[model samples]
Target: MVQEEKIPSHVAIIMDGNGRWAKKRGLPRIFGHRAGVKAVEKIVSHAANIGIKYLSLFAFSTENWLRPKDEVSGLMMLLSEFVDKKFFEIIEKDIKFVVSGRLIDLPDEPRSKVLKLIETSKNNTGMVLNLALNYGGRKEIVDAVNKILASDIKDIDEKVFSGFLYSPEVPDIDLLIRTSGEMRISNFMLWRLAYAELYFTKTLWPDFDEAEFDKAIFDYQNRDRRFGMTDEQIRRGNI
Candidate 1:
């Protein structure tokens, strides 16, 4: 069992290198995407089983829209199929599914599936599974600002500004994990990941199994999240 005090309240992941995995195997990129979905399934189940309060997966980004049409189309189909196949299982496990980003960019089929998942998972009281589709950190901040400007409240702080984000119900990210050795944040969860501990691994998305995930979690538990306080201040529990 995880120590309650050491568990990260929120964890975010950037699932990268699906295309590279497929290419290395002399298979189509879509093959890797399909495999990556399976990895997602395994990780989500494991995270919930471990009592992780929040898990965010970077499934797609705004930049991903610039990819080849055929590849993009395949990704959308895979997403819809994943929802259709996993919806019932999610409900049975009492896991809440949440999505971040603009739904306008999604096709009707996947959009419908995503909406259905969010609607169905509304009452679930367990771990939240967040998907970042067509999402960008800069865009999120811009949207938040636009919302703040449109409102009558002249004074704006971090707490009030956060309410305009896509999934304000979810708290700030505590741990951010990116696979395939990527060092960049790639414009995901800009505001929510401000204080998140970052973990980077060379394992591709399809290969990121429970063992790899556990390593990340274990490392997270070993960190000293002082949040800018002095060592003495934190030791005294007065910061």
Candidate 2:
């Protein structure tokens, strides 16, 4: 069971392995993507119900654009449909819908829908659902730097630089969950995941459920997040 007091403020997930899951079941990859969307709906609702402040999902990466045209088109269509269907539900649940990427890169219809969702939910006082669509961790850093260079500021630190991120309102990730047995971050959130507890599951994204989420939370609670402190210092509450 997850300890309510210790619930992570921000949880980021690298939803992976839709292709492999589809292959295993002798179905098209799009089928797996569709199933993954169902799992996303379940997780988003559960996260909000569990008092998570921010939930960041790696929905689409900038690199993902290199995929076959048909798959990409299907994904775009699916995304548009999802936004259309979930707009009302997001409002009803008081969830803030936000995107953390180059929104202009999206197709016209989906981009319009995404913008509408963000505008509509901007004032929601509930959990933030941050979708990393067409996002790249390295690109984010580069863009931040470019913005800094364009400014007149001569010097800055990490804290100051963070304000230039795509979703600066969202805090650093507390726990990062990667599914499909992946052992890597895959350029998800390089800056924000600096000290996050990593939880990797072999379960495919389509199969990840509330139980799996709880298991990850349970594992996080058991670990000692000493950061850079020694074990003795942690024991002495010298954090």
lDDT of 2: 0.95
Query: How much does candidate 1 score in TM-score?
Result: 0.97
Q: For residues 1-239, write the lDDT of model 1, one tens digit per residue.
A: 34666888899999999999999999999999999999999999999988799999999999999999999999999999999999999999999999999888899999999999999999999999999988999998998889888889898888998899998998999999999998999988988888899999999999999999989999999888888888899999975
For each candidate in turn, the TM-score is 0.97, 0.98
List the candidate 2 regions with Cα displacement exceeding 4 Å: none
Top-lDDT candidate index: 2
Candidate 2 lDDT, 193-220, residue by residue in tens: 9999999999999999999999998898
For candidate 1, the per-residue lDDT at 82 reads 96
